[model samples]
Target chain A: MNSSHLSLGDSEIRIRMLSQVYSASYLTRKKEREEKSKLLEQLYVHDVYDRIASDFEEQQYQPWPKVKDFLLGLESGSLVADVGCGNGHYLNVNPNISVIGVDRSFNLLRAAESRVPGVNCRADCVALPFRDNQFDAVLFIGVMHHLVSSERQVKALLELSRILRPGGTILLYTWAYEQQKRKFNGQDLLVPRYPSVGEDNPHCNCHRPTTKSSGDQLLTLPNQSQLSVLDKLERIFVRPFNLFINLFKLNSHGDSIETGESKDYINSVPSTQSDTLDDKSINLITKCSNSIYSNTLSHSDYHYDSMILVPKEFRVREFPASSLFSVSKVLNGKVSVHKRDCVSHSTNPARSRDDRFYHVFKRGELENLIKSSKSNLVVSKCYYTSGYWCATITKNTL
Target chain B: MKILTHNMLTSNIIKSVKDGYPLKIAATEVQEVDVDFNPEFIQRLLAKLNWSVICEAITQLDATKDIELPENLTDEVKEDEDMLRKIHHVLLEVEVIEGKLICPETGREFPINKGIPNMLLNDEEV
Candidate 1:
C-alpha cells in the first residue's frame, strides 16, 4: 500500500464524517427554526389579536364599500363564510345571507359571537373545519397577509377552495405594499396594533382607517429620510455593535440572525395618490402620542418560557450607510416616530409586541399565488382598493 | 355553535384522518336562541348539507325538546313550511353552548366553549 494513497483515503473518511456532523447540525437548525416560526406565529398573530379584541371592536371598522357591495350583490339565503371575521364586522353586513365567521383568536370570536351570535368559531384559516364544497361564497377579507409564508398562504387559499362550492365566489383582501401612510421595507413587516393606546386615549376617538374619505388614520411609520445627523451618527456607531451581536450569535448558535436582502419593490411601485399628509392622521397622531410608548412593550417584556426567534423573512433590512446619509432632514416634532428595524438591536426595543406580522403583497403577487396553487379557481376580478389588494376568485363549476 | 354550523364542520384537518365528516357531538350545555325563521334559507342549506349528518348531530345533542327532522329530506319537505320550520329551529335556533366535537374516524375531541367549536390543531396534532 502506498503511504500517499493511505493518507488520501484517511482524509476522504474524515471529510465524510465531517459532512455527517454538518448535516446533523443542519437538521437540528431547521427543526429549531420551525419551532421558532410556530411560536412567533402564535405570539404575534394569534395572541396579539386576542389581547386587542375589544379595542379592535371599538375601532368600528365599517365594511369597505367594495366588500359591502359584493355582499349586497349575493343572492338571498347565500351561505357565506367570513374567514377572519374580527368582531364580525362583515358577518351581518347583509341580513339576507346566512354568514358564519371564523377566526383563530377566541377573544375576537367571542366578540363576534356577541354581535353575530353563534356564527363565529375559533379555527385556523389554513385548516378550516368546514366540509368540502359547502358554501355559495367565502369572504377571506384582510386575513391572508397574517400568514408568514407563501406556502402557508397557498395552503389557506387551497383550504378556502376546498370548502367553496362549484361556482362559489371568494372575496379576498390583503395589505398592499404600495400604501400611502405606512412604508414597508419588504413584503414581510410588522404593523403595530395599539390596543391599550386606544383605550387609554378614549378622548382621541381614533377610528379604524377605512376606504371612506372620513376615515381616520393613526400611526404613521417613521420616515427614514427624516433622521437627524445625531441619529445617523448613532446608527453608524450602532452598526458595529449590531455586527458584534450577530458575530456572538454566530459563535454561540452556529447561525446568524441578521437579514441581508432589502430591495425588490419598495420604490418600483407607483403611488396612485399623491403623498399629501391627511389631517385626520395628523390629529390622531397628536392626541395619542403620549400613551403610545407606555402601551407598546417589547417582546422580551412578555417573558415566554421558550426561546423566541423572529423569522428571518419577518425581519426588516438594516438601514444601509448610503441611504442613512442621503436622507433629507425634514423633522416634524408633532408626529411620533418608531424604528422599522425593531428586531435587530437590543438597545432599541421600541417595537410593540402588539405589532402583528404582515406580509404585504406586491401588485400581482396575490394573483400569482392563486394561479400557482393550480387549484380550480380563476381570478374573476382583482384591484387595489384603500391600501389593499382585493380580488374576487371563482371556483370552476365544470 | 348552531347545528347548522356543525353540519359543515369536519375533523379532516387532522393529518391521520382521511375523512372526518359528520363529527359526533356531546353536548354539556345547549341553548335555543330565537332567530327569524326563513323557509328559503332552510331550503338553500338543505341543498348543500347532508340530511343524514344533520339528523345524526341533532340526535347527538340529547335535547329533551322533541325536535325531529324528517328521516330523509324530500322535495315535499322543502315545500312544507312545518317541516322546514323544524329544520330551521334545529339548524339556526338550537345552540350547543358547551360541548365536544368527537372526530368520527380518530375519536379526537375538539372542545366547544362559549358556543364556539375550536377546530384549530396544535403543531403536533397536525
Candidate 2:
C-alpha cells in the first residue's frame, strides 16, 4: 500500500482519534479485541517497518557480536532459520551453515533480497510456513516486542518451538523495559524514526528561503503586508522539510529553543498512545493546518506538494496537511519531539508522523511467556546484555 | 525457492489441515546456478531430507532433469561420490526463480516472487 491511503483527511482523523481507545463494553467481545489488535499491528508494526525499510538500512547497523559469535559456532551444513531477519545481515554470518530468513514486511524482505539473494522470504513469526521440527536452530531477534500483546508473544514463542528440532536451540533478543538511557513510563511505547525526508540539507539548494526576495525564484515567501497569518503558514507548510533544521535545533539546545507556554509544551509527558495527538501545542498546529488546507481548496496551485521532498512511496504519507502544518508550528516555537532515549535522538524523525510501536519486555517477561506457552523449550541461558533482555532456549530431546 | 528449503515447508498451518508436507511447486522460471559440490555435506543432509520430496520437486520443476533414487538412503549411495554430487546439484544448484508453493491438501497457493516465497497468510486465514 502507498502512503496516499495513510494521509488522514479531516473526518478520518476524527474517526481514528475516537476509535483509539476501546470502550469497556466493546472490549468484552472477543471479535472486537481481535480486530483492534490487528489494526494496531498494521498501523504500528507492519506498516511502519515497510515504510521505513530503505531508510532503516541506510543507517549503519553493526551486527551484535554475541549473536554473530553464536552463528559462527554452528556446525557446517546446519539448516538454520533466521526469523525476523531484517536486511538478512546474519544469513551469511557462517558460510558453511545454510540459513533461510523470513520477515513480515515485504519491503524488508526485498531489502534482504538485495543483500543476500534467494535466502529470505515473507512470513509472520506467529504463523511460520515451515513444517514441524524443520530447523536445527532458529534466530528470533528483535521480533517478540512487535507482537503487540502477551498472548501473541507467547503464541510466537510456541510457534518457534514447534518448528525447532527436539535437541536444537533458539537465540532470542528483545528490548528491555529497564534501560540505562531512556526511562519508559509503561511497558508499551511508540519510538520515533527520522528517515531523511529528502537530501541531507534542503538549505543547501538555491531556493533556501532568505529575506532577499526575487520574482524569478521558484518559491516566493514575500513579506506581503496584506498576507494573513494563515497565508504565511501555508508558505511555510509548502516547504516543510526546511522545518527539520529548526526541530534539530530544538532537540540539541533542549528548552532554550522554546520559551513560556511553549516550554511547558516541551516539558509535558509524551502521550503513550500513538493515536492520541491531543497535546496543547499539537492541537494548535492541527487547527492552523486544517484552516490553511480549507483556504487552499479554491486555489489548487497553493496545495503543498509533499512529493517533491518525500520518496514516491512516502508521498503525502503520515505527514499530510495536518502533520505538515504542525511541523511549521514546531518550527515557530513549540517543541514536540518525544524524549526517547532508547533510540539516538540525532536521527529522531518527527514524532507526530513516524512513531514506531514497541512493547518493551520486562525482566523475566520472556521466561514467563515461554513457561506459560507450555512448550518443551527450556531456557538454557538468560541475561541482560547491552541494554537488551536476551535468552537462549533449547528444545528438550525428551 | 531451493528444493532444500521447500522440503521442510508445510501447509499444516491452514485450518483443519494436517500433514502438509511436500508442497507442490509450479515453477514459472527455473535457474541452475553453480554451487560448490560438497559430498560430505550432501551425505550429512541426506539423513534429514525426505528422498521422495526431492524427487517430486525435481520432476515438478523440470521433468527432463529427473533422476531416480531409492525411497531411503542406502550405504552404497551415500559412499558413491557421483551420486552424492547429483544429490547436491538437485538440492542446492537448482533454484526456482519464480513459482508458487501450493498446499497439497487445501490448494492454498503461496506465491514466490524474485525467488522468495511469501508464506504470509491473511489475518482471517491465520
Candidate 3:
C-alpha cells in the first residue's frame, strides 16, 4: 500500500515524527509552549524555508504541490482567510493571494506578520469579527481541532457557517482516524495512525500487516506504541479554575465579555492580558484543562474533537461532524511518511514528544505579555510542518 | 537591517538548526539598502532565499515588477552574472538607513544609525 513517491531520505523522517508529538502534546500546558512557539519562529527564518524552498524551488517556493494556476486565482483580490495560520505558512506561501490569517496563539501571529507582508487579523473562530458572508472564499487549511470540547467544536463550526456567504467555498485539512487498531513492533499500544482503510474507505487499500489485541484486531507498529499514553494530571486540584475560563471569553467578539481589546487584552497600561481577571476564574479553567490534557487520553482530550465548516444556511447530515473534520477534510494533503520511517529504524526512537518544539500555548499565556503591549502582534496557527509548534502572532496596527 | 532578517539568525541556527548548510547571517547592521539588482547574484540568491519571502521583501521594497518569480530555477532566473550582481546589490548592498531592528520576540527596538546597528541590550531588553 506504500506509494513509490513515499520514500523519505533520512533527516525528513526525524522532523516528521518530531512534528507529530509536538502538535499532539505541546499546547496542553504553558511553560514549554512558549519556548516552542518562539523556536518555530526561528526555524522558518533560518532552517526550514531554505531547505523546503529547494524542494519547491522549481515550484516557486510554495510548499503545496500543484499550486501555480490555482493560486493565481487569489490575485484577483478574492478575500481569503488562513484559519489557524501558524506563522502564516500558507498565507505567506503564495504572496499573490488576497488573504487574512487568524489564530488563538499570539506569539506566532507576531512572527508570521513579520515574515509575511500584508496579512490582516481578526479575533476568533468561536465568534468572528466580520459581517455575514463577507469573504469570497475561506481557507481552514491545516487548523481546527485544537478546541478541546465538543461544544467548542460545534461552536466553531456554527460560527464558520454563519460567516460564509452563499456560494462561498471553504477548504480545510487535518488528521484522519484509522479503524484497524495497531500496535508497534508486537507491543500492545499504537503510536500514531492514518485512517485505516475501513470497510467504507474509498481511497486507501486495506493492506497493512496487523495483529490481534485483547480479542480486538490491531495493526502492528514497527517498534513502539503509536498513540501516546499521557501523564495523569490532578484535576481536582485544577477544577475551580476551569470554570472561570469558560465563563470569561478573552476572544472578545462573543458578546458582552471584554473585547480583549483596549487596556485589557495586554494593553500594558492599567491591565495586562492575564490580569483582566476581575474574577480569578480564567486561570482556574486554564489550569484544569491543562491538567486534563496532561493527563491520560480520553474523550475530553483535544485530539478527539472535530472541526468542520457548513454554510450558515445549511444543515449537515449523515457524517458525525467530528469524524468529518478529522478524517475527511483535515487529512486532504499529501502525507510524507518520511519521519515515521525514521523512527522505525532509529538507534533510539521515541513516539511521544522527543521535545516540546511542536507545541502551541493556551489563550492565557498568550495574553500575559500582550495586554497593554502594542508591538504589532497577531496570532494564527501555521500549516503543519516542522517538529515544532507554529504560530502567526503579528500586530494588526503595525 | 529589517527585523525579519534578524529573526532567522541565531549563532546556533546555522550550525544546529539545520546542518552547516547555509551560513546564518547574524548581522549587527544588515541595512536593507535600495540597490539595483546584480542580475547574477539575484540568480544565485534565488537558490538561497525562500522565494516567497524574497518576493515578499521585494514587494515591500518594490511592487512595480509583475509578481513573477522563477517557477523552476532552470526555467526561471538564469545564472547570469548581471542578475546575481543585481540581487547582490538589492539584498546585501541595500541600506535600511531610517528604521530600527526590534527583538523578534519582545518588539524592543535597537536603533541603526549611519549604517551601524545597535543590538546592545538595556536592562529592559535583556
Candidate 4:
C-alpha cells in the first residue's frame, strides 16, 4: 500500500497516466491532504465490513434483478469473475455460466462458501489472482469506490480489462453521487454507523437534542424576553430554585416518564427554565437538562440504552460521472462516461444514512462515462433497475 | 485453478518479473470434474488461448497420459468432436488442487492451495 515500494519509473508512469484521468486539483482534494492518515482510512473501510459481515450478508440475500438478467444473457459455460462479490449473491444467478467470486473479507467469503461451496477466492481487485484474458465476462459491481484514490480505481479497471478476453462483456455497478432522494455535502465522506435495534423499537427513538421531533416540548418553555422587568427580576432569583425542584420531580416520577405517562411533568420542567431565557437560550437549556435527565434515568430501566452510537466509520466516495470525462480521454476516447439517476440498492439503512457519502448516479451518467472514456468498450445496453445504474459494456472486436 | 484460468494469467504484473507468463505448472493433485459441454463456447475460447503454452502446462502437470492434443489448432480439428472434448477437458475440467506455478523468466513460484491460485506479489514487486 506504500508508494515507496513501486519502482521510480513505474510509479512515475502510473502517476502520469492517472493524471490524465484526474486533474491536479481533483487529486489534491482530501486524499492527498490527508496522506498521512490514508492507512487509517483504508482500515476503516475494510474493517467496518469485517465487523458487520454477518449483518451485511443478511440484508444482501436478494440480488439486483438487472444484474441477474445480465448474467443470464451470457452464453452458457462462459467463465465469469465477480470482483468484490459479497456473499456470492450473484454466483447462483445462472447455473450455466461459471462464476469465480473474489473479495477481500474472509468473513464475507465464509458466508459465500456456505451459499455456494466452490469458486470463491480471497483476493484484492487491484491484483486479482486470475490469469490474463481469462474470463468471457467480468463484474466490478460496488467494488471500485472502495478504492481510496482515482489512481487505484483506474488501475482496477485496467486489471479487469487485462483479464477480459477481447470482445468480452463487463458488467459494472457503482454508487452514484447524484440521486433523486438524497443530497451529499462532498464526494468523500466518513459515514457514521448506528447500531440497529430491531422491530422492538421501530422508531429508533433516542435523545437527539437537535432533532425537530422535540420541537413541541421546546415550544412549551417560556421566553425570557416576554417577561416584564419585575417578572424578570423575580425569575433570576427563582431560576436555580426551580431547576432543583424540577430535578427532584424527575427522580420522584422517573417510573412515570419511562412509561410515557409523565409528559405533563416533563413539559412543566422546561416551562420553569424558559421563564428566565429567550427562545434560543431556552432550547440550549432544555437540551442540557434533557441530557442530564436521560443520563441519570438511563441507568434505571430505560429502553434507550441500545441507542448509543457505535464508534465505527465507513469511508465512501461519490463520483460525479461527468468528472470521469478526463479519465475517458486517457483511454483514447474508447470509454464513455454517463450520469444516471437510480435508487441506491444498499439495503442496510445504517450504510445509506445521511452521514454516509454516496455517489448516486443521475440518469444517463453511466452511459456517459463509457462513451466519454473513448475506450474500445461500447455501451451495448444500459438502464436503471432495482435501484442501481447498471451497464454492460463490450470490448469492440478489432 | 483450472488450466484454462492458468492460460490467461501472467506473473509479469510486477515490474521485476518480466515475461512472467506461461507459468510452468508443478501440480501435486489434479482433479477432473464434469462440466456441461458447449461446442460453440469451446470453439470461441480456443481462439484466445495460447496453444503451445497450454501444451507445455499440460505436460508439466503430467496430465498428458489420457489427452493427446496437437501443437496447434487447425480448421479440421475444430470440426472434430473428440478433439474438442479433449481440449475442453484440459481447459475447464482439469483443476490443480495443490501445486506451484513457476514463473518462466524469474523462476518465482506462486503457490496454489485447494484449487485457488495466489498471484499476489510482494510490496516491492508491485
Best by DockQ: 1
| TM score of chain A per candidate | 0.60, 0.56, 0.35, 0.50
Whole-model alpha-carbon lDDT for candidate 4? 0.53
- Candidate number of the best TM-score: 1
Error of 2 at A366 (Å): 1.6
- Cα lDDT tens digits, model 1, B1-126, are 888788788898999988898898998999878898878877876887779888878777767246777787889889998888888888888888998999999999999999999898988777
TM-score of chain B of 2: 0.92
For model 2, residues A1-398, the per-residue Cα lDDT tens digits are 35555555666655554444333222343344346456667776788778767764665566766788999998877889999898787888887788888998888888777776677778888888888897899998888777765556766888999999999999998876544323333345444444333243321111011111211111111122213422543353334422212111111211111122233221233324332333453435434434444322111111112111111121221211222222322233652332332233333323323455566665555665565467899887776654456788899987
- Candidate 4: interface RMSD in Å? 3.4
DockQ of 2: 0.50
- Model 1 agreement with the true structure over A87-122: per-residue lDDT tens digits: 787888887788999998899899889887777788
Give the better candidate number (3 or 4) by DockQ: 4
The candidate 4 chain A region of ten consecutive residues with least summed lDDT is A205-214
Cα error, candidate 3, residue B126 (Å): 36
lDDT of 3 by residue, A47-68 (tens): 3222222222122222333122
In order of appearance, the predictions have TM-scores of 0.70, 0.66, 0.31, 0.55
Q: How high is the TM-score of chain A in model 1?
A: 0.60
Task: Return the TM-score for candidate 1, rounded to 2 decimals.
Answer: 0.70
Runs of candidate 4 exceeding 4 Å displacement: A1-42, A47-60, A76-79, A95-100, A106-122, A128-136, A165-167, A178-185, A189-382, A394-398, B38-40, B62-66
How would you encode candidate 4's per-residue C-alpha lDDT over A131-167 as one tens digit per residue? 7667899987876545544335445666777778789
Clashing pairs in 1: none
- TM-score-wise, the better of 2 and 4 is 2
